[model samples]
Target: MYAIVNIAGQQFKIEQGQEIFVHRLDGEEGAAVEFDQVLLVDQDGKVNVGTPVVEGAKVNGKILAHVRGDKVKVFKKKRRKGYQKETGHRQDLSKILIEKITF
Candidate 1:
């Protein structure tokens, strides 16, 4: 079975035993977390979709690690204006292991 769930304001398509990196969450490594905002689920040939979100549906995952994503550089320049800017950023992320989806 697979499910589309909302985690940390982002939607992810997940399946059992799969690991995904999402926006940083408020929990320590190895902690258990549950996401209730399941938008859709498909089991074999059966499908269940929610109004906004599926009622009585949930996704459970375990926090495997906390990490940072790759750095992104931003550069801006204006010709003949002698203006230039450079910046970089990296996003904090958490690795989660999807354990199960239940309704």
Candidate 2:
């Protein structure tokens, strides 16, 4: 079975044994986390949706590792103003392995 869940202000469709990268979480490797904001679930072609979230529905996941995304370069220039700016950024991320989804 699979379900749509909310994680770090984002929605994701996930299934058991699946791995996904989400916004950074305050957990160490091998730590466990629970996502209680399950929006919908599909099993055997049957779909269950909630008003906001499904009551008594949850998704269990294990923290695999903490990671960083590739650097992004931002450059700005104003022609004839002799002004230029450059910046770079990298987003912190976390890897989680879905263990189960129960409703």
Runs in model 1 deviating more than 4 A are: none
Which residue pairs collide, candidate 1?
none
Q: Candidate 2: RMSD over Cα atoms? A: 0.8
Query: Model 2, 93: alpha-carbon shift in Å?
Result: 0.3
Candidate 2 per-residue lDDT over residues 1-103, each given as its tens digit: 8999999999999999999999999989999999999999998899999899989999999999999999999999999999999999999999999999999
9-97 per-residue lDDT for model 1 (tens digits): 88999999999999999999999999999999999979999999999999989999999999999999999999999999999999999
Query: How many pairs in model 1 have backbone atoms within 3 A of each other, for residues 3 or more apart or on separate chains, i.e. clashes?
Result: 0
Give the number of the best model, judged by TM-score. Answer: 1
Q: What is the TM-score of each candidate against the true structure?
A: 0.97, 0.96
Off by over 4 Å in 2: none
Scored against the true structure, residue 62 in model 1 reaches a CA lDDT of 98
lDDT on C-alpha atoms for all candidate structures = 0.96, 0.96
